[model samples]
Target: MQQLAFYQSLWATERRRPGVPERPVSERFDAVKADGYHGMAIDLGAMTLEQARATVPEFARTGLGGLLTAFPQSVDDLRPAIRLAKDIGSPFLIVIGQVMPLSVAGMIPVIREWLALARAEGMPLQFETHRDCITNDLFATVQLLDAIPEMRMAADLSHYVVNREMLYPIRPEYRALISRVLARCDSFQGRVASRNQVQVPIGFPQHAKWVATFLDWWTEGLAGWRGRAGPDDTAIFMCELGPPEYALTDARGDELSDRRQEALQIRAMVEDRWKALGA
Candidate 1:
């Protein structure tokens, strides 16, 4: 059976309560495990290797495995992150780009370098579809894909939906683009988005259409993954509904809804959809 892993945005959690101190890794790990998540994805950009290493045992204690999301400033810096992933026995390293290359040709070398780094370390890495990085603009990623035929991506469509300010009921032309992305996508991320906002909670009336749109995208993306993958391969759809500021708010700065509850709801929805796909 394939497993679903939830990526924890520990930094976002900490940012929500500005005056309060951030929770310890142990606390975060316990909370996620209790919520019934099988695994975790930890973004280690803000921490030192030593600090990240120290936190690994906490994940193990909760019977929860984790993949590290490393922000590598240079190609060579990826090795340490891959080494850390190997130490934790993570199946893959999720790479989030920090630099934006000027041209698709420039981006090709960067992808090659990352692939080499992962291959040299005997680990696997997938570039995340995110904004403000090498794949910042959706069109640029399409261009990069043309240059490198075998590149794999972890699809976080929320970014692209927001990046392009995608209109609802998705235009027919845009649907074709989305289909192309689904075909090549190796993994998925969960978060409802509108053209203007990336992380809206799933229940509010105003957000209903957006929520429905994301679920449809998730369905399409999941089916695509299943078609390409064998029965033994796990498909990871990370429910990364981050805390406030990533989670939207009103003028007063209060959250749109309870994010913890929203995440659990999203998890339930994903499970139901996965079951239907199998049937």
Candidate 2:
């Protein structure tokens, strides 16, 4: 079976706790493992290279290893983070581009630069579909794909749902566009979103329609991946349901429920979809 991992926004959330000492990376690793997660995608956008290197050993201690998600400003800036990923035994170096250029043509050089760097360093790389980055806008990303045929992506459809403002009960036209994205994606992310909202709690009555919409998209995406990929290919599925603010939090700063449980639920859903596709 393809491996699944959780995304850790540890650096971002650790700072949110005013009085509490930041949770040890070991603690974060333990938390995910206890929740039945196989691995974790370390979000390094909030940390410097040196900080990331210092923190990775903690993840290694927990036996969790996966991608390093970064928003490096320059291609060369990715060197240490890539090295850190290698040290942690993560096979993928995932980049969610942060610097946006004036035009689609302007974005090519950045992609080329990162591609060159990854190639030179022997690091596997994939761009993530996320907001406030070079791939921020869905329309622009389509253009970028046409320009660069080799560009691989990790699909986080929450951003595109918000970018396009897709209504519930996905229209065939919108579904077609999404299918294009699914065709290009090598990995999938976990999050349920409506056209208007980026993140919504799973299992809420109001969020059910959007959740179903995402499930349908995931089914299609996974089926497409399985069909296109060879027997040796492994497609990653990341359960990235974020915490506190990204998750719904109650009073007293505690999460409404367990975010880890929510991630597991999403993982199960994806696994079921993949199995159904196989059947």
Candidate 3:
């Protein structure tokens, strides 16, 4: 049977509030495990490979899985992360390639190199569709997908929505492009965004439309994944509600909403979507 595994972003645990002290790593892992999360995501964007490796024993101690989100600034940058991911028993690594080439043609060789590296390491790698990354532009990403048929992606549609400044009742062209993306996506991330904002409170009444849009997309994506996945394969959906600037805050720098609750809600929503697909 196809299974669904939910992960919490370790980076999202940062409470950058003025007076609040950050929780210890063990406590954070305990909290995630207590909340029924299957794993915790370690972001290499903010931590070194050595730093990421330190958390491996903690994950083992907590009996929870670990996932690596790598920010590879160059082709060679991914090798160490891949080795670390394999050493730590991570199911896969998500790459947000910071090595931007000038054109789609220029990007081809870079992507091919990384994919080859992942294969050689015997680790699964998925390029994330994110802003400020190689897959930054929506149109360009579509073109790249066409150019590299073997490329797979981790869908974070929040970036594309903001990248295109998508309007209400999404345009046909944009919807088609997004459909193409969904078709190739092997995993997905949870975050709601409007045309102008990267992360929005899904439960807020003002953000209802954007919330609905994301849920619908997720449902479609999950259904498509189910159709293609093997019987014993599992689909991973990460609840990555970010911290500080990625999260909206008030005058006092306190977050406008409770991210932990929002992340749980997103997890529940995805679980429901997975269940809706039947056994």
Candidate 4:
């Protein structure tokens, strides 16, 4: 049977509220486990290798599965992260390559090099579709995928929604492009976005249409994964609602909505989609 595992983002636990101290790693791990998450994700994009390494013990203590999202500043920067992920028993590493190349031709070698390195290290790796990285532009990412058919991606389409400033009733061309990306996406992340905003409150009335758009994309992505994935294969759907700037804040620097509640709601939506697949 193909199984769907939901993972919580450790970085999302960050409140970054004024005068509010950060929660300890153990406490975050406890909360995730208690919430019934199958695993947790650590973002090297936001944390250093040492900082990410420090959480290994907590992951073990809680008996939770782990995933690492790496922001490799250089092609070789991914090497250490890969080693650490293997050491911590992470199933795979998600690469958000910070090394930006100016043109599509310029980007191919960089991606190929990193993919080759991951293979050499015997690490399962997926390039993330994100902003401010190698796969920054939607058109560029489509070009890269066409050029490198073997490359797999962790789809975080919120970035594209914001990047393209996509309008509701998305243009046919845009929808087709997203379909292409979803076809090759090996994993998915949950974060709804509108044309102007990167992260919107899912339950907000004004954001309902955007939320519906994201749900539809996720449903299509999950169904595509099931079509190709073998029996006993497990796919991870990450609820990665971010914090602070990635998350909207009011004048007092307080989040407008309950992030934890939002995460749970997104997780449930994905879970329902998975169940509907009968996988």
| Predicted candidate 3 versus true structure: per-residue lDDT over 69-117, tens digit per residue | 8999888888899888876678888999999998999999999999998
- Return the TM-score for each candidate structure: 0.93, 0.90, 0.97, 0.98
Expressed as tens digits, the lDDT of each residue in 1-279 for candidate 1 is 655455554444443665667787778777878877777776776568888888778766877777777888888888788888977767888788876689888888998888887887888777888887888877888877778777778888899899999988788877888777777787788888889988887887888998888788888888888887876888887778777778778787778788778877887887788889888
* Candidate that would win on lDDT: 4
Q: lDDT tens digits, residues 1-279, model 4?
A: 899999998999888777889999899999999999999999987788899889988878998899999999898999999988976678889999999999999999999999999999999889898999999999999999999998999999999999999999899999999999999998999999999999999889999988888999999999999999999999999999999898898888888888899999999888888898884
Go through the candidates in order and give the C-alpha RMSD of each one to the true structure.
1.8, 2.4, 1.1, 0.9
- Local error of candidate 1 at 91, Å? 1.1
Candidate with best TM-score: 4
For candidate 3, give the lDDT.
0.89
Candidate 1 — what's its lDDT? 0.78
How far residue 176's Cα lies from its native spot in candidate 4, in Å, is 0.5
- Cα deviation at 44, candidate 2, in Å, is 1.2
lDDT of each: 0.78, 0.76, 0.89, 0.91
In model 2, the clashing pairs are none
Runs in model 2 lying further than 4 Å from the true structure: 1-21, 250-254
Better of 3 and 4 by TM-score: 4
